[model samples]
Target: MLEVNHLRFSYGKNPVLRDIHFRAVSGEMVCILGPNGTGKSTLFKCMLGLLRGWDGKIALNGEDIRQMKPGERAKKMAYIPQAANPAFAYSVLDMVTMGTTAGLHGLRVPGKKERTIAEAALEKLGIGHLLERDYTSLSGGEQQLVLIARALAQGSNTLIMDEPTSSLDYGNQVRVELQLRKLTEEGYSIIQSMHNPEQAYLFADRVVGLRDGYVIADGSPKDILNEELIEKLYRISVRKVDAEDGKGRFFEVIY
Candidate 1:
């Protein structure tokens, strides 16, 4: 389990996150929902140890992450950032193999075991055919999947993604969401920051709503993602409608 308590952060004197608290358990998907610049990314940076001077606690499986070394932390969690543009056109397999570096020693190169792990990750995400392709040549969604495969190869039980579907088309968005759900079912804890409340409603077991650096709400998506909260979060009118198939609900913004 991942637990965060009374988390607070600031840039110099400009406070960003305050009293943020949440927990994500294995086999569960949690979505952090809020408008842009509500410190969602900042909160993620704090959890990932990319930022310092944070006041509070972030722990994974009862161990304080702040007390762990960089390599030790990587063993506990993995982060998938927004799609990156690689300077060099590295092959998909090479990119995925990079995840194994944290587990390797000095002057030691990836051999059969690392290659196998990378191959397994790609196969798990149904992208094994792209193994020999250049990562830069793939579409946004494919690149995103490759990044996820890298994280999977990292062998952490917890995955943190920043706007995993932000740059994808409708079809790709749905595809990524479905894959995330599958990962959770396979017992990988996922924490992703997203701006879409409907995605939260459809895919998240828990939703954490952040507004102006504060946790405005935290609960199951069905209970916490109502029209009122939607309006409050985005400052825009929206309505919730039951899906035709009755599997779940979706939010429609009223412009």
Candidate 2:
């Protein structure tokens, strides 16, 4: 459902992404794993058309993303950043309902339908109680769920998130991962940049390893993750163990 080819981007004289080529199929969960300053975030920005001045092609559903209009892109792609610091003190419901702005432009504001979608998204994320509370006053994990609800309310086919579980505790992280798996099962394409390799191994159907702005490995988590590759990419040795799921593919990072 999403294809990126020979993608290259830079800031001033320093290059960030170099000749990156990958694809994500419908109902697939792809995890982008990379170290700090490895251009994972930059690639996401380019995919969302948030950054320009790059060389190469990014296509969404067979159309060049650069040529698509913003609103049109919004309808196809939903983005949830690693961190969001909204300036205003909007309620959780208000923040999530903003996702419909691109599709609900004719009206002065979001209508009942839009509100329903936003509220449903929040409820699905298990943050419905926070709907009436101030978004800024919530904890980090709560804010993250609210942002994800906002993205879901956008009603897009592809969901792209950067470090969606960066600040959450173990319980919350598991909740988010299960929800992500559920989203994929329901036929949504997901592309996420993640720092945790264990989470990637458990949740992602495919893993793309990036290092120094280059594509290092692209394959199934079992095919791409190993002692050597883990050491090379993350400078750590991870031990894989038998999982309770009996899938013959479950692993854990034994630091």
Candidate 1 residue 196 Cα shift, in angstroms, is 1.0
Best by TM-score: 1
Residues 88-123, model 2: lDDT tens digits = 999999999999887976657898999999999998
Instruction: Determine which window of 10 residues in candidate 1 has minimal summed lDDT.
Output: 246-255
Each candidate's clash count: 0, 0
Model 1 per-residue lDDT at 177: 87
Backbone clashes in model 2: 0
Model 1 Cα lDDT, one tens digit per residue, 116-172: 999999999999999999999999999999999999999988999999999899899
lDDT on C-alpha atoms for all candidate structures: 0.92, 0.88
